[model samples]
Target: MPILDPLSFECVSHSDEQTQRLGARFAQAIPPVCVVALQGDLGAGKTHFARGIGMGWGAAQELRSPTFTMLQEHHREPDAGARLYHVDLYRAERAEDVASTGLLELLEDNDGVIVIEWPERAWDQLPPEALRVRFAVTAPSKRNLTFSTQSASAWQTLLKFRKLAFGV
Candidate 1:
């Protein structure tokens, strides 16, 4: 492990399960109304990571990529009003395409936690406070996940996640 900066840190996942566990640890520390921007190539563990987030967040169903559907909403149990919105902008080519998914409204309303895949497609639309996670494939079953954000609260969240996931 390396020394982690307050605003950024890196974690290496040796398997899909490890990636998902890392994400689950993140979910434990994330705020109720937050945006997570997932950046990486296809099959870079975004969806699997998201699945762990959903599981940790106590979603009623499994979280899956909303590539074709564009968005998928998962309601949390015991508190059905609390929700998680998974958005995929892979098919979007412009900001206008992102607007069609009503993401801006969701962000403004602060209704629930939102996880966006292919966020580069609508960089301008994302909130400045959004936590950004970049993934890189290192081997057939290995990945490097880099988490970063400028927002103070988001950085604190990452710190908490680090303590929970890494015990340091």
Candidate 2:
């Protein structure tokens, strides 16, 4: 069980299609009841990556950063009943402010897949099983994405998933 191993990958993509490809891969990899924390600066493709997750979940509505909306719920294709919650905490002035949004309560209620943007704002709010995805811009449309897991077993599983995905 090497799920906790760290995995890294690089992709050269531009425009929304590139983002969709990355999202497709992630959508296939992620399972139900998974929590993903996306961290990156503005225009760092955090939302782009999340777009993929939403697609994977079969969400039909347009994918956009929930910066202003705070959180948006969408579903994958028809068969997949699991829902995807796109949550953006970019505007929260403080960690305490996050509670006002009721995002925590949402997580507790459904246990569905959650993709959180600006996750650092709620550092103490995430559960121990949450998966952390940190993004760094490598080039204009290129990104360096790293997947890390805090739990020992989770790290091994995630790394294994990455290896199976990248095949390197």
Q: lDDT scores for all predictions?
A: 0.89, 0.74
lDDT string for model 2 (1-168, tens) is: 123344333434455566666666776766677788989888887888888777655787867888887888886566457678889999988766788777889767855888999989998878777778777777777766667767775555465555555664
On a 0 to 100 scale, what is the lDDT of residue 134 in model 1? 89
Candidate 2 has a TM-score of: 0.82
Worst 10 residues of 2 by lDDT: 1-10
lDDT of 1 by residue, 36-148 (tens): 99999999999888888999998999998899989999998889999899999999887788889888888888788999999899888788789999899999999989988
Top lDDT model: 1
TM-score of each: 0.95, 0.82
- List candidate 1 stretches off by more than 4 Å: 3-6
Single out the weakest 10-residue window by summed lDDT for candidate 1. 1-10
Error of 1 at 15 (Å): 1.0
Clashes of each: 0, 18
lDDT, candidate 2, at 139:
78
Model 2 residue 70 distance off true place after TM-score fit, in angstroms: 0.3
Query: How far out, in Å, is residue 50 in model 2?
Result: 0.4
